[model samples]
Target: MDTRPRRRRWPIVAAGVAAFTASAAIFSQIAFAATLFSDNFEDGDLGGWSKSGGTWAVVSDGSKALNQSNSGSENAREFAGDTGWTNYTVSARVKPTSLPGNGLAGLLARAKSSTTFYRLALVPGGVQLQAVNSGSVTVLGQVSRTVSTGTWYTLSLTVSGSTISGAVDGASVGSGSSSVASSGRIGVQTAYAAASFDDVTVSDTAGPAPTTTGPTPTKSPTPTKSPTPTPTSGGGGSTPTGSWPSSTGSVSVSGTIKVSGSLDGGMKRYCCIGDGSQSESQDPMFELADGATLKNVIIGSPAGDGVHCLGRCTIQNVWWEDVGEDAATFLGTSGGDSYVIGGGARSASDKVFQHNGNGTVHISGFYASDIGKLYRGCGNCTNHYERHVTVDNVLLNKAKYVVGINTNWGDTATLTRVVVQSSSGIHVCAEYTGVAKGSEPKYLGDGMGDGHCNFTSSDITYK
Candidate 1:
């Protein structure tokens, strides 16, 4: 049986993050450097970040950073990650600019709320690690050391199963066991203090040498896969806010890079491939072998052929700066599954996804803009396969058509929570008549059909 797409709503992450874009916004989960989320707040806007009981904005403190500027708000808090983040490290540069005598500037992990989380905080008398639940606080570990108001300190907090550990400026502050909150969001907090935070980042820190952590940087660095499989539910501990992200850095690809296990780009821009014009001979920048997984990568302009999957694969939290020939192509025929989750694509002069294989392609919590087609089932491929796709919680920004399918081949597309951001009138599902390899596919009418498109007008929303 096919699984219904699960909707994920997380916070505004950095460019390095997998879901939404912000500072570093490098998103992926599993092991060391598998950055699931980060934000420098350089974009000067908090698009996907959530706030509670605080006055917050992007303020320059050395550089762009999220700052809570209200000392009177006793429980000022801001979140920039998913509620499903578990077994990860959340770190940030924190400066207590206006702390009261007993106020605290803290970094939070497994934050279920503004007051509920495991915290590594700088207090007046010292540093403390505590578990706070429903506004109630319990100290798990503490170290006595005075902190300077104007000085910056690196606060690092790691949560694994029941073990919680924290550090300050590379120095161990505390480690202990706690069950207060096992899994939640990542954020920054202040209690009776105003502070500036920067370079906020979350990376995978548990599971052995992280050998299988993710992308060992081989071939050039030869990448490795994390022993941990990303939950089919969440990739970067965050949900996208339906906007494009900035690139923290860029990688030039000379040729197609083959991925055998998994490759997490940590949300870097991979470009230098082809021209923006449609060309059939353009090589893909990355190719995934059967069962391979690609995460937290941004495909920049001239994006040859975005990504190709030979068999079962997962495209998690990947953004396309510009759509190439196609954003991603699924060529798997093994009746396995492929997923496109939590990312956005823009300036797609063509289709965003091409399905030329068997089995199902599930896309959930995704954003698309100015595209010819968000998804297309192979219309004239040599092999006749029954393809299926389920799209849920997606924002279609001025999209021409949501999905195009070959009705003759028995292709099916299911759409839900599709927010259409344009009055241009998009085709929810456009049907086509498959032809031979040499002929063009014929276009058919669109609407909910018995077996082709399984959705009603209620499944779509106009904005």
Candidate 2:
């Protein structure tokens, strides 16, 4: 889904080690501790590091360094070292290649997991010191600083006791406290950005004292400020009103909200978390039970896997300002019907709607722009469910394909009135031969129109 698209232990450090020599006790001997681990990438291998999302490789940026090239990846992390690493200083040279809108890149430390850690990220808010727990970010401290592209900067993060502090190029990034992540691993990360990292090193130490800087003012991007969903005229045939929604307020969703009956967001914006990044294991923002309904909600940035229709559900007039992983996924197999009516999604690096469940996903009056595929039937679900999708009167802007179906799995995609530009180079219907799990689906072709495609030449109107 190009979708474009850590540290080691040391001895002698007196702080945050479970078992060590007599002098290697706890925080008592931090001053005596020296360098424990270091990596420059000249060896051209990510040996001890574990990666999550993003296309990473060893490249020469001045000298040999590790680079993460997938700018669009969310929360791309490369972790190394021991998980029991507590009270340590992790430092590295970071140079961002790109930072799209809300993108961020930098070093990490005390990472309890790929999702939780203390980081010194170069982001829109400048260099930040924050505690990220399961993707729920809490800014412990921040300092307004310039983060120009292609400029190599020295970033350092240290975690000791409850204090988590960071710095960039020797200037203090401020500090914060977090008891939740008292001890963990060390690593590097990027969110919707690409960066090269080198000269990574760790020692038993803590950062400087927290600076006295006040919280810097920041602004959130308004990417999907429109898509005012009109009431569905005929269940799923309401046109998107181009007017973006002005949020009444915002709610940071740390965990998935289970909807057993129905819940209305009252025009509120909810978002920015999933357990991890673009992986299949990401938690959805909202998880609907069998026969549930979610409506009038605006999904904000870093939307974790969007919504999940577990059985059969109705997603009506919902607008996704920024999609994560995918806008929404229909977990099939109940043979129950799911309806996506009168909503719009934008900035979906992958499919806007994923049909992995059995039954049919009836999508109408929906609008998707800046997307890879508007609707995709699971090509290798392993369950071999016959997923079907019907997209009608959907406006696809700057899309790669309107719908992609796996014909071998008896998947069907019926698209009608798909509005797009003639020269957009967008595919109408792409057919693929489904494969078993762990294999990529073979591309059969595009627009065969046969039974699986089920569309005519005039079905798509070139505006």
Candidate 3:
């Protein structure tokens, strides 16, 4: 009599095996097969690394090297089991030093179980590529410059076949292509900042190379009408109008198309349409094989001010209730990546992300009830770039005057297992002249009422 559905157990701390032939004599002459983990904060053998519950510190890098600190500000640095390989390639050299707002250094790939993972951070301001499945967080890439706090920087990641390329000191910024599940296990992430990782390596390559960029030429221009308006047998349905395939032009649809209407201002209500007006071919909605899902949708009014998603789209289990002002907006002039898995929105007054120039908005398993504000760029709006908003397993109930989750701009939001019982649970408007001012929303989570939660947001980090 086991009716299933009862699995939420977490508590496994086992990571003490650093004997790779004694650091393989210090990187074994570095050529390919590599592995090295350190923390001279005191003891040695952190080879299998483990320290994620409370006061974390391996400090003591005044000379001999080995660091990880968090005296009182919440901490994290996990490295569970080693999910093996599927065309691997991981490298590190980090050095994050005095971090408080730009603190994060990375390399956590394919980690399927231990709450899932796929990070690649290195922040000072630049290089970041995340993917913490199951538990949320899905920022695929970032590279706005900043990367020089205490020195050292040589991060590298390579997951062949489904893409996932990354390189820092050597060059190559970020790359993506995922089937969603490749192979897992691999860690080393730092959040309250304070970093110093050296050598560390993981092997296996030859994967990544399977897109000749062929067939994908339709040029979109057919919708003279038919935006989906013929379901009378279904009572409440009637708000289908179409016309958008002119600007940069791009519209792809492989299947699934069910729009009950409600997207007048967000402009044309596209289930698939690109050319929002060139920030790199604006309006882009791509879902090739086994991708593309939008149900009971509504993105009311958005004519020449928002909505831009370049490639790779996913808006599953949808429902954007009454989105008129701004319910979904993500712009990337020369960069791209947008994903919104599982949706639910109520009122959207003006901010959900306005002038996102660089591009990146990942809201996992979302549920926004009364959002009047939640943004990245509103300061009069310009080319405004740099954004990586990840809200996994979210639930923002009754958000009156909400603002914090990644305010101001330069964005990098990550809230796992989130639950903002908002009267106002996060507000930040300091940068571009108070953007649009809307304060009195601060709640970092500790109310502990079993909303099934997790938190991360001095900027975000909880690998």
Candidate 4:
């Protein structure tokens, strides 16, 4: 009896291989090393690539390319190449055909697995660089740039030592660093977005360094300081006050802290936080590291995600209003436990909770309104147990979608005493039905066990 769980085998179709190699007849100006892996998708198949999530197919018509139209959290990666290389560059031509409200399509490098990788995401209005270790996502760098949908752009990331630099087209965007995992696989990923990738190339060879005139200082966005978190009477450690640019402000303590006043932000949403040495226009209001507890705090008028929870975090009795995006976004690795209890939110510009990576999320007594989805899963995923979601005594008012389990495959979600008073009723699996659009469909049936959602409630109302 093999007690090991059986992995599902996906169908791989053969595609036609093209015949256009680099002809020696054309003299090269720059001497480059041997290509590590190159796929034009002319073969019309994902012959050597393995997918962690999403339904991918080699589209042969019009032009040969690897297409991922499946919604939810899906990433297709190639695992045969060298995962131990120290210095290498991964490049791809990406085109986002369609995007969801908060969709992201990007390339992955140094992927130790599906969940741990250095990702360069092309978001709706900007680009983001994230370092995901196991399930913890650290925003290495982020910058806002106008990205036109349905347009193809060439993107690349070069990792040499601790520094990871990203470029789009031919211009430099930003860079971030991570001392975690050094090397892994390279791949493509999308969340609630339809995208096609072509001319995928990975080269360990070094390219000629461009001529630099001088040290051109990268301009930071318009600075808007966050309100100081006032320390109440109870907590032991001194509350960290003063205005910091981003959520990189560190806080370490054992007890709870109260944010007595509202921290207000502007309308411009930032893509990524600079390395914290520079001022930022839009960033998470508070950056909570591992083992932090925040209580009775209010975040207002945030242009980006409100709180970024890294490790085991408990946020209770918190409220958010006029938030630009997710009120609280959790990105924890190391099997961290994230809890949001006894909170109320209103006038949310987007969803209330954006839970990603690998963590056990317990959300209860949260009343959110004028928002999108109340809960979403695995915006960025890992091979580890995606996220164990538990929702109890939650009320959603006039939200677009209720709950979404957007794991790679067979995500587990549990709901009890969850009520919704919206025109769309209670959406059990909104990611599959809405993003997948029935092409390669996923659904919620039965209860919670292998591709099913466990939902038990009778108080849901719609008018």
TM value for model 1 = 0.50
Q: Give the lDDT of residue 232 in candidate 2.
A: 45
Cα deviation in Å at residue 175, candidate 3?
25
Which lDDT tens digits does candidate 4 get at residues 8-28? Answer: 222222231122234533644
For TM-score, candidate 1 versus 4, the one ahead is 1
lDDT by residue (102-149, candidate 2, tens digit) is 899988887664555677889864877777643446776677867889
Structure candidate 2, residue pairs in collision: 2-5, 6-186, 6-187, 14-29, 225-244, 226-243, 226-244, 332-357, 332-358, 333-358
lDDT of all predictions? 0.76, 0.74, 0.46, 0.59
The parts of candidate 4 lying over 4 Å away from their true place are: 1-32, 74-80, 206-385, 388-463
lDDT of 1 by residue, 1-463 (tens): 3232222233434554443334233543433346677677776777756665568888877677788888976567776776767788888999998878869999999876444588899998778777764444667666777788888999988888887777887777756667888788887888789899988878765542221121111122111212223346546324446767767788988889899988888888988787777786788888999888888888888888889899878888889878868989999876656888788888887799999887678888898888889999988888766677878888888889999987655566878888888738688899888787878899988948334576788998898
* Sequence-dependent TM-score of model 3: 0.26
- Candidate 1: list runs displaced more than 4 Å: 1-230, 233-239
Best by lDDT: 1
Q: Which of 1 and 2 is the better model by TM-score?
A: 1
The CA root-mean-square deviation of candidate 1, after full C-alpha superposition on the true structure, stands at: 23.5
lDDT of 4: 0.59
Residue pairs whose backbone atoms clash in candidate 4: 15-43, 16-43, 115-382, 142-272
